[model samples]
Target: MSHLPTLNTDTIWAILNEEIDDKIVNQLVWHYLGYRYNESKQIWDTSAVAEEWREKYPEPPDFIANRPPTVQLTRSIPKENKQLLKEYLGFKGYKIGEFGPRQTRRATMANWLLSYLKEKQMLA
Candidate 1:
């Protein structure tokens, strides 16, 4: 009887730039480390077993059992493609979020932005 609200690429892009905020990032890190979000507390509650696994493994899961290899955000994407993506997003009034100590994942952002632009035909 419940329905999930429909969301468009514009909304998703906005959420990516706006709603995935610092507090949310911390929550995501905690959840990725295996804690569940506590709605009332607005925090993630860590489990002992999750903490143990994290201590043992320390790194995030690199692959899914039956899925393609993860996208390499660290690899350098071509500068021309990168600039095209930025120009498209800027034309559409979308601002990219700055992340990380070294800002290494801009390639992934570029990919998403360009795909959205192409989908919306804001880019030729």
Candidate 2:
């Protein structure tokens, strides 16, 4: 059997929640959003749509792979994804106990959650 790194999701979550800075989150989020897996074209079947989005948004300085727009996971992320999600949402500076305030923008949270599951190796 291969020796894979076993990360403590809870520990990661705690660091992200009580310690991590917004800059890292922003960077990670940017990476996650602009990420394009090598198999994007073959898997996403969105050659046209991705092009459209690219045209709309200015090209990033770094080459974030041309991936499918939708956040799809092939395997499980770590549980930390969920904790990071909660922190991400909280970082948005939204008020709690409010009724669906303004617009619903939780893409970061969703993406983090997905990534967490994948990290945990639970999505397989």
Candidate 3:
């Protein structure tokens, strides 16, 4: 089983200060459930076309055989939330692009929310 990350508000400050990587921020704040980095569903074994290719060439070239698996994200935030967060980040003088993508924006929003809750003593 994959493990969920433990997160904290300092992660946000690190992102804002450019001390932390955007990928890390995304992983910590927005990775969808059951997602582990570089883990993805494979089509080579299931696709009819791929199976046909295997029958024609039993031994694939090294490049094809050793190709790294890629990950397809299930997505981080809902569309409605993305729009709201985009507008909010823009209002705060941030370029949404700076956050990396949907997942990164979700991280930023999460950091902001955590900070807010902390300030209000709502989080321990």
Candidate 4:
């Protein structure tokens, strides 16, 4: 009854896929699995390796659980800004398709906008 939303393994995996480097994803997954396995064994030894793993892969924020279960961070963009961004990207010849498959265009745009906004200090 903690009232905190629970995040399952799949959700964690998806978030990790978006936010982390692919090279380290498998290592983190194996480390997490090992931690869970040791936890299940009930000996509960806090080994240095386990501590290191926790330091590297801290728990996701409680807010993440409350938000919609999507990799993209939710934010409202003004219609004018959206149009301006589209025009800007077009002018710069940065085609979304050039970056990746068609399905990923929205994610690509969201990430680009997030970076833009952060650089302008509009988002912290």
User: Model 1: per-residue lDDT, tens digit, 1-124?
Assistant: 0121123344334434554433333233233335454578875345532554445434433322211212332122345554543464453433367344212222244343455345456554
Alpha-carbon RMSD, each predicted model:
11.1, 10.9, 12.2, 14.0
Off by over 4 Å in 4: 1-74, 91-102, 105-115, 118-124
TM-score, every prediction: 0.29, 0.31, 0.31, 0.24
Give one digit per residue, the lDDT tens place, for model 4 in 7-123.
233323343235533323323323322332244564433343344434543432122222321222223344445443335432232355564332243333333343344445554
lDDT of each: 0.38, 0.36, 0.38, 0.34
Q: Model 3, residue 82: displacement in angstroms?
A: 12
lDDT of 2 at 21: 40
Over 4 Å off, model 3? 1-6, 32-34, 37-122
Collision pairs in model 4? none
Give a tens-digit lDDT track for model 3, residues 17-84: 56655455444432322123333653223232244334543322221112211111112234344333
Decreasing lDDT order of the candidates: 1, 3, 2, 4
Comparing 3 and 4 by TM-score, which wins? 3
Per-prediction backbone clash count:
0, 12, 0, 0
lDDT of 4 at 63: 24
Candidate 1 residue runs with Cα over 4 Å from true position: 1-9, 20-71, 74-80, 91-107, 116-124
Cα error, candidate 4, residue 11 (Å): 26
